[model samples]
Target chain A: MHEEDRQLVRTLIRGDAAAFRNFFDDYFPRLFRFILRRVNGDEESARDVVQSALIRAVRKLDTYRGEASLFTWLCQVTRNELADQVAKSVRQETYMRRLVDLEDDPQARGILESIPAGGEAEPESVRQREDLAALVHAALDYLPSKYARVLELKYMEDLSVEGIAEAMGVTAIAVQSLLARARVAFRDVGETLLPSLGGNW
Target chain B: MDTQPDPRADEPPTDDLARLIRRAGRRPQPDPEMHAAVRAAVEREWSAHASHGGRRGAMVLGVAAALAALAIGLSWYSLHPGAPAGSAEVGTFVAARGPVHVAPTDGHEMVVAGSRLNAGSSIETGPAGYALLTVASVAARLGPGSLLKLNRPGHVELVRGRIYADSGSPSAPPDALVIDTAFGQVTHLGTQFQVRVDPEAMSVSVRDGKVLVSQGGGRSITIDRGQGLRVSSDGEVSRLNVAPYGANWAWVSEFSPNFPIDGRPLSAFLSWYARETGLTLVLRRPVTQADLDRPTLSGSITGLSPAQALAAVMATTQFEYDMTVPGELRIESRATRGAN
Candidate 1:
């Protein structure tokens, strides 16, 4: 996977137009969703931060060593950009205040601690459902692109196995196998990350 | 593989999980305009990097060229020990406020006091920013919303906004600070002057001494002390009488370079105050030259405006000051106060 990402980066640095487009199209939306969650869904601020991160990443493309997947590296860069934006702006106070409140409130702490390991049960309230959605999206963000795409094709697009295979250009059997792996990956990552949100997911 | 039961065999049905996943995916995507703008900016950066074979290569090349130049410069300096090193650095920022930025070859970086500016550098002030630099021995102040480029030691291009230049005392040899603008070129003749550029016109106002404004087609106008000249975009010229001090000159003192008062003579502080405020300094009869030359000042007057510094510094001396005549500050012995 890293070798494939390095090859794509080489093509991008060589000024291949199609490679550049694919790079932006593949990672930009995922990175945007990743940052949007952190910025309390302020879409405009998220867009600005994502744009700055992508521009910086492209400029520093030659420095990418492929030690991590390209999307993970991009997320690191986006986090730095988000941190800079937060420092430079007073507008993130509401988002920051909610995080502080979460740290202090025992009820919020209890909700986070009560989340089951498998994450199979439905959330108890409408608010928890919204938080669950955010956790699911964040989990999808952490997955490999192929896994995330296959899962999205299956669940969000409401595609049958044959439809997922057609969209992914794979066999129906392959789609089923990828779906099985994706579901487990989603559950494992969500279990690890959801608690960190402290009931604000 | 055969021993492991299918992971999906015990998995819950897809109906409920699909709803959750679909709801998560419903978050907002980038708007079309923002997507396009980001794509455009990213592609531009990618092209820049690609054209240079990536920034790493460009940086390596830049370093190599700099090293090669340094080697030659060092060899030349070795043979000529008395000669000055050839450096592009033209000045150091004496004061800066708000978001004053300096861009050399790479990109813009915020400037602070003591920031060295090279000859080819560009200085830009944010809407609330002000900066003071001594370039080529001339005190140059950039007003807010100004962009000035240092072309060489004594020449600059005023791209937009206002810049004030003080070419030291009238008796000193003129370094001839030349400023190029949209309307014409202004070269000061050992004087203090301001050049302002607006969208429709360019104006040059002189506070002391004189400056020669040369317009296109070989037309030239010499503006003396206390005069202002305006040239419209269509080349129409107008003149007006301006005062040497008052509300017009107040902004310059707001970010005036710090005056080090530690162990300095009282006369030196008064000299700085006079130049900064465009006021004449007069010592009354009882205030002897010996009194003015005494090094009695100690401590700091930092972060104080010119008027405040004047009051603070004067309160420590045996002299008092009066500004009853607008452009002149009178100093007299405290013992002789109100005797006139």
Candidate 2:
């Protein structure tokens, strides 16, 4: 929205390669750092998300009305791309579950066993961690989409109550109410699925 | 469904819990090379858009070309079945394992090593069985429980089960490569790919090069290397990125036929090995084409797949190879020559 960024946008849209290169030098590190944190130190994913974000940014530069700082716009693109990746992974997990839902065929389980646990962690520990994460993901899946979205903003994006309210176009009190209900439902689902964790947590 | 927030409890995660959330986001920065590569890609996209007049024009041209290719492939597969394609024999079977059989339109017969197959021949395998046959320079591995019939119109019909096909050498024309499935037609250009057809859905995973996957009526999508698509019977397609050499491809690796490198030029051997393993052989600086051409590798790779064989053999040679991308094999020639 600044006058300076608006001029840069005008230059970028005019097919000025030098201007674009300058923009890349200015923004690549900032964008890469943001995506790196979001992807939990997964360098490969950070690179992919940043590349995709930059490509979209370049292609849609003409449509950039300079309503927000260019970096903010780029971050929004990266967030959407990261969400797409998560949803894709969820779909793959769902598909794999459906593949051998019959009786948990040992042959299929053998294929899954080959997946490395990373670092020096034991396979059993990794499996336990994955199992807990799966349970949490399942609980989240059971919540209404609106409820899940609020919780994701609160937890995953680390947005504040007021920020969540602003993002959801609601009041902070309403956001508080939504978060409380989401947590309760998430707990109920987790309890019905795995009771030991329910009591301990 | 009852929809109401509890009146008694209106709360959020405590400050400590919020700290936990923030901790989740703490991650180390990516490598500088990765950032540079991404920046370069953005520049390339911008240049491409400018060169093609615009992204819209480029996309239109790409879609038009894709549609033309798909139409040709669909017409190729829709030819009459059981018709002989030129001479009866495409090529002789170089290797076969377990109970491999070929059932013609009239009767059934067992397939053996060096046995030639014709258009009417329906190749099959029983439980815990597989077959590897070389049809031209191209090598195809028929996995267990597969039934394949070489069709008349220059395509192989996979009735069901899995087939790993690698059209050897990028120079070899893709004139004879078409895999017909119930869901669609899969054609590739000197590539390594696997087509698995079950009773419910058909999946095509490309390891290298590009594959034209046509679901008929001009509906086709070009799946590039490291990408896979699963098409349900209702023509629903879901794509996933493929790690070609990962555990997901272990079964395919187990079925790879022997690639002899003894008394062969290093270049030819590497090209064949890379093609079979779905790797694009890259020769780095100091490793010229002359090195690939002149060096006559004198070794034996008996039972290993292309990837394993490359590892074991490259250790004995001056060249070192690594998987640079999902399906690329980059060979780096070291400064100190020979096995050091």
Candidate 3:
């Protein structure tokens, strides 16, 4: 956008290491700080995101059409990468939470605590978990791949609607609509069949 | 139609989704070692590119090298190349010199190549080549000199290759097909199974669940638990009732002589013990899935690292298990082994 920025871009395109060094040194801290706020005080994660954005920019240097400012492109890439990581953490949290929920449920907790800690899964309980998982899986299978991917990216990956749209190459509004539709589909299927499978939908 | 309501109506549309999307956009920085490795890779590329001199020459050479690698890479397909009808697409194929492109034929075709296959998409190789294909969600590690074909009706055949099929759940179809030299053609029946095919002996290891191994000449043997089978290429199937501890446990077990527990199942545990103690456990009968999943017996057998602990358990318990080999014990006693 600016003459100086355009010059920097030309230098980077030419593979000038000095230009890259200047760019990296100047922008690295700003990018790190920006990432830090997003990552919620995880210094290591913030550092990771900033470095990744820089490396990606370097790799795809040829693909830069200069349609958007360098800053905008970099920010776009940075957001996508962070969203993917967040989604992973979210999925882990959800799964572990589900496992914990089984232990904390008023009725279930009594049955669970009856056994020693670190003990084997009671056959009945294991069967129940397995059965529930199977029912959930079956319902998941009925949904389209796009919906599944969106749900996974959202709830599992904790990606924002805009982030999903970007990764999926769709409009943010489209993602919103898709999520709405997907929930309806899930809940409809859950109500119709999951209860019959003896699972609380 | 009026009775059908939207699931998302209760939850208002929010901007958090967009924020999450923006957040996921951030890139992940590589570890210091990875950064160093990437730098090294770049340096290597730079050196190779700079060697030729001139910008055009460097660019041309770089592109050529990349294309060649990609072409050599063309031979290998990571996933199930299950011919989903219609015209067969050309997946990657790697060869001795480099990678080649192989398209599926209407009938059978074989291609010879080298280099371990790193990945694939719906691609299966013939028995003549070695590959690791990731079809569907499962990653199947193939042995050298094996013929594997990919078709919709179960990714068809593996004529002679050692394969470890990490087939994804039962809901998903079998991602790979294996025809072991020792055992018969075995489909991925919702579990990880290894088939090793060699001249003197061929064997099948059912890592999880059961594998119905059909012998080449139409006979089939169902091997479950830690059991395996030895069959010749000539189609003579010899059931190896011996618990394949060494073979099964090598990858799955998380224990050692020093640390005691390595997070492997009994199959893996038995395999590791066999390897360490130079003994084999010949089971009088099979262990049930319920027995295996019981957790008490499945995980690391605590204090069993020392012979004293083994003897103590033996002396205290009514469980009848005899040491078939010096260190290997077969559970012959009906009484359950005491919970660890």
> Which candidate ranks first by DockQ, i.e. highest?
1
Question: Which candidate tops TM-score?
Answer: 1
Cα-based lDDT at residue A144, candidate 2:
52
Residue-by-residue lDDT tens digits, candidate 1, A56-158: 9998999999999898889999999888877864746755775777777899789776766544553555557777777787778788777888778776777
For each of the candidates, the C-alpha root-mean-square deviation to the true structure, in angstroms, is: 21.4, 24.2, 25.8
Chain B TM-score, model 2, reads 0.60
TM-score per model (chain B): 0.70, 0.60, 0.37
Each prediction's fraction of true contacts recovered = 0.42, 0.29, 0.04
- TM-score, per-candidate, Cα-based: 0.49, 0.42, 0.27
Model 3 agreement with the true structure over B191-301: per-residue lDDT tens digits: 656766544346777655567776545777788756777665455666665444443333222211222434433444444444443355555444453343333332234
Give each prediction's DockQ, rounded to 2 decimals. 0.17, 0.12, 0.03
Give each candidate's interface RMSD in Å: 16.5, 15.9, 18.9
> How do the residues B10-109 of candidate 2 rate in per-residue lDDT, one tens digit apiece?
4545543343324334223345345445655776676554432231210000001111211111000001122233546655565544334443322112
- Over 4 Å off, model 1: A1-201, B1-92, B105-116, B338-340
The sequence of per-residue lDDT tens digits that candidate 1 reaches over residues B1-340 is 1223345823544555566677776645665446545766776677667743432210000001111211111000001011123547767666555434454423213334565666766676544456778777788898866888878777888887788888778754564578999899998788888888765578888999999899878999999999999887778899979888875576677666667899999999998899998999988887877889985699888767788889999998888999998899999988888565
Q: What are the clashing pairs of model 2?
A: none
- Score candidate 2 by TM-score against the native: 0.42
Which runs of model 2 end up more than 4 angstroms from their true locations? A1-201, B1-91, B105-110, B134-138, B169-175, B216-218, B243-245, B280-287, B320-340
Candidate 3: tens digits of C-alpha lDDT, residues A26-71: 3454455456556544556666666666666666655656676565
